[model samples]
Target: MAAIPKTHRRVVLVRRPPGEPAETDFRVEEVPVPEPRHGEVLVKVLYLSLDPYQRGRMRDAASYAPAVGLNEVMTGGTVGEVVASHNPRFKAGDIVEDRLGWQEYAIGGGPNLRIVDATVAPISTANGVLGMPGMTAYFGLLDVGQPKPGETIIVSAASGAVGQVVGQIGKIMGCRVVGIAGGAKKCGFVTGELGFDACLDYKAETDLDAALRTACPHGIDVYFDNVGGEISDAVLRNINTFGRVALCGSISQYNAATPPMGPRLMGTFVGKRVTARGFIVTDFAERYAPARRQMGEWIRSGRLKYREDVVEGIDKAPRAFIGMLRGENFGKMLVKLA
Candidate 1:
């Protein structure tokens, strides 16, 4: 075995931000590597996922999950190789996935950690397409949105990690998939590359409602919402009767100091009879095995395509995360820790 280092680098949440987080909110510090206790394994993180949800974790407020306490390692999903072990289920050199936070190494295992097979896919995928984002897309779309053939599906943040998968899955279900992306470049990728029927550039569009109405002539039947600001208002206005909406991430509102209010859409909901529900990926944890198996099959067969926008090092995580919140990342944003 390679010699274990006595110290490692970690990014800690120094202070909760009032609004969109600045780089100063996080500080990189070198700390002594923790030794594994009984039934634990020490892992050297290789890839750390930078997601918009982590932005919500920065605030000291009530949320679905606990906030990252001041001066603690910023929580995140990671894929790493076990370098030392005191547990039988995991051992030296075993690649595994865990919520190990934004650190070079971590010491914990058991129920929260699962061994990953690199042969099935690249280990980095444990944080991206074949991981949380993928699972979120699968359940949120098929189970909640329940798209049907010839129906129209509109996805916000369409070039993003979960959005891309949600759009593709809508296509496979024989729905007319229309994506709402930031710029012309991303819009082109959504329609030209990912096979979406049409993509609207939200940044360029002067009247979003007209654009949506033009693109989705039949009206939106399934709205896979990733962003929840003005974009949602436009989509809600055009929802067909009996439409279903899967409320996923709200990246547009994540960085706000005060909750941004829009026109109440209760009338639309009542008139359309829209079914809207919010969900987290872990909400469907018990069924992950089968869902992952099917996603893996689609990936292997080339039916489901994915993209990754990976930054080079752990120190870049803060900037990458901020960029993601600003709609900068093209796909899954990750920091390569190795």
Candidate 2:
């Protein structure tokens, strides 16, 4: 159980930026610690998830997820330990799920939380590999990408949280996995540690077309798109007939002030008869147990590995979150609460 405080620190979105969010746009403010009334519990946040999708919500525009209002706390998933509870289902010391935003404390009511064995994995895993991003890679690849054994799969942002898991899972399933990440370091990690068959450094690729052609010599059967600008367009040009594409996060367009330019590879989709679909993790929340179970089994068997670039202190979450947008983070970006 955590020592309940009278006040707690929270990161507020003080201003909605015209384009990308600056550090000053977010304000670190202290608020009164809320008391849990009946059927409620107070959660002391242990870790906060920082993802590229959060960038879309920072803008005041219509999006899949609602925008964060000015002066409101930035929205995000959190793993927290319950300190006080008036609910029968939850009690002190129980670690639970929460969308508590960038805050140190939260009063949760109703049934949004999913109780977990905090010891099963590190508490932070629930916010990354064992959490939403993990499930996203699983469902997106298995259900959408339909990576068959012996098929050639190409995944972008290969060194990031979702991409690494997808590549590892693809490898385990007998598929040949190729990855695209920024810089030489990330490319090395993706090919060496993550066990991808081949990796291309997007930053170093002088000719994206040549790289795509060389990497996907067998013709790409599945494209796990993470950045949906020129990189995705280049991948689309080489897709095999009846290939599939999983439209995951589009970090390339996330920070753009205006609509991003594209290679306009829509014609290739028609010629290749490719199937591309966009999905949100919430769509498969019902199947979370199965995914989590599979992940646990993989982890125990050592077939799957997860890497997180954790930043210490809740006060630093804003900086970490911004860094993720700029592709400065490697693997899962998370902040340990102060």
Candidates' TM-scores? 0.98, 0.97
Best prediction by TM-score: 1
- The lDDT of each candidate is 0.92, 0.88
Which numbered prediction scores highest in lDDT against the true structure? 1
Candidate 2 per-residue lDDT, tens place, 211-285, comes to: 878877898999999998888888888889999999997888877778677777778778888899999988898
lDDT of 1 by residue, 93-150 (tens): 9999989999999986869799887877788888888899999999999999999999
What's the residue-level lDDT of 14 in candidate 1? Answer: 96
User: Residue 74 in model 2: shift from native, Å?
Assistant: 0.7
The deviation in Å at residue 312 for candidate 2 is: 1.2
